[model samples]
Each structure stands twice: as structure tokens, then as C-alpha cells.
Target: MMGRLARQGGLAVGERIRFDGQVRLVLAVTGRAVILSELTSEPRLVPPAALFADGDFEIVDISGRMPLPPLSLLETLPQPVLEKALWWEGHILEILHGQAPDAPQGAEVRPEYAPTRSLTARERAKAGW
Candidate 1:
């Protein structure tokens, strides 16, 4: 039944399907009628037969799940820093929060700025000794 369904294009891309207690998303279908791009921790392409057997398969369209931006280290940054550092961050925040940058848009971000440090000759001498 799974093979027949796969061959007949019953599965849609980004559609969530379950086989043998594993949940996967169909990413694409090929000329060989194979369900390609099964979602796991990582995507794995395999024959539909290996996925579905004993007439036990379930498919659910989860395309409506809110789209998440690709994960990155930037997610940890303060909102102000993110907005100031990257243009895309501002856009992402706008889409997610439904608002614009609150910290005065178009403000210049200076990456080269650094606080000055005062060094004492006594401290340098103590280190040398």
C-alpha cells in the first residue's frame, strides 16, 4: 500500500508521514517513484518499502507549522546587538515580533570601536620582575 501510494504521488513535499513508529517529512519524489528526503535528525532517502509495511502507515500534512529561521549562534545575542549587527536579524525580528527596531533605525554600527585601556609602568615592572 505504501509503495502504491508513493508511486501514485499521494505524498506531498513537506508532508509529515509516519512508518514503523518513525516520523519523517517527504521532501521530494523522483522518477523511480521513491520518497526522497525523509526527515530524521538528518534527512535520509530510502525506499518506501523499507519505510512502510504491514499496511501500517500514517501521513499528516504539517506544512502549517510555523517556519523557523535556521538556527545559529546569533540567537543568543541581545536584541539590540542583533538588530545593530545584521540587517537580516532586524527583518527576522520584525516578522517574528511584528514590529520594527525600537532602538532608532538607521543608526550606524561601528565594529571598530574599542574601549581604551590604561597600563601602568608599575604593573609592567611587577610582571617583568
Candidate 2:
């Protein structure tokens, strides 16, 4: 079901879709609506569900992930910098996932309630959040 939904209506900005009798480009996707336009007409925000419900609908091309900018990097960073970047990514994932990343195998420890460590600044901040 998710795959079908994506194929039919999960359009991204700059994606070209063969809609109606001509090709239209997705200008933007906001909330439940998709803004689309062709060279001959002004853009219109239409519900994706309704836009793809009927008529000729096909994804012609996807420019959603234009990579020309990233491809310009000619050299990798220093090893230490790369390691720090990776560590930063882990921190971002921890926040996004609402928990710290798991320990490596054999490093897991049982949960313990340390009364002495209670109400610390970090714990207080977490509770406030």
C-alpha cells in the first residue's frame, strides 16, 4: 500500500510527471497538496490524492535529489574530521530516535536507578523537553 501511494502521489519538488494531457512539473509539496505547473500555465496546488486519482498520470523524471552540488567535492576530509562527522551523525540520530544509540555487542549493561544521580541537569533538561 505504501509503495502504491508513493508511486501515485508521493511527488517531490522538481519531479516531472505526465499529468492530464501534458507534462507537468511538481513545484512543491506542502501538507496534503502538491503544487504543479507546466510551461504554458501558472502553478496550482492540488490535492495529490485527487490529482493522481484519474487521467494520464506517470512520473516522467525525478529531480528531487539533484546531486550536482555534492558531486563537486574533489577530496575527502582528514580522518579525524571524518570521525567527528560520523560521531555528530550519531548524536543527531540519537535525538531523532528519542534514545541514545545502542552499545556494541557485549557492552550492554542492565538499567540501574542511581538515586544519587537523580535530578541532575541533564536529567532535568530531558524531563523538561
What C-alpha lDDT do the candidate models reach, one value each?
0.46, 0.53
Candidate 2 per-residue lDDT over residues 19-127, each given as its tens digit: 7777887775655687888576688778867777746777888543322234123238777776686676554333222234444433422222111222232244444
- Model 1 scores a C-alpha lDDT of 0.46
lDDT of 2: 0.53
Kindly report which residue pairs in candidate 2 clash with one another.
Answer: none
TM-score of each: 0.34, 0.44
**Clash number for every model?**
0, 0
Off by over 4 Å in 2: 1-5, 67-129
Per-residue lDDT of model 1, residues 1-129, tens digit only = 534455322344456777656766676443334354544455666565555552547775544222445648777889887757677655433332223344354443222210011123222332353
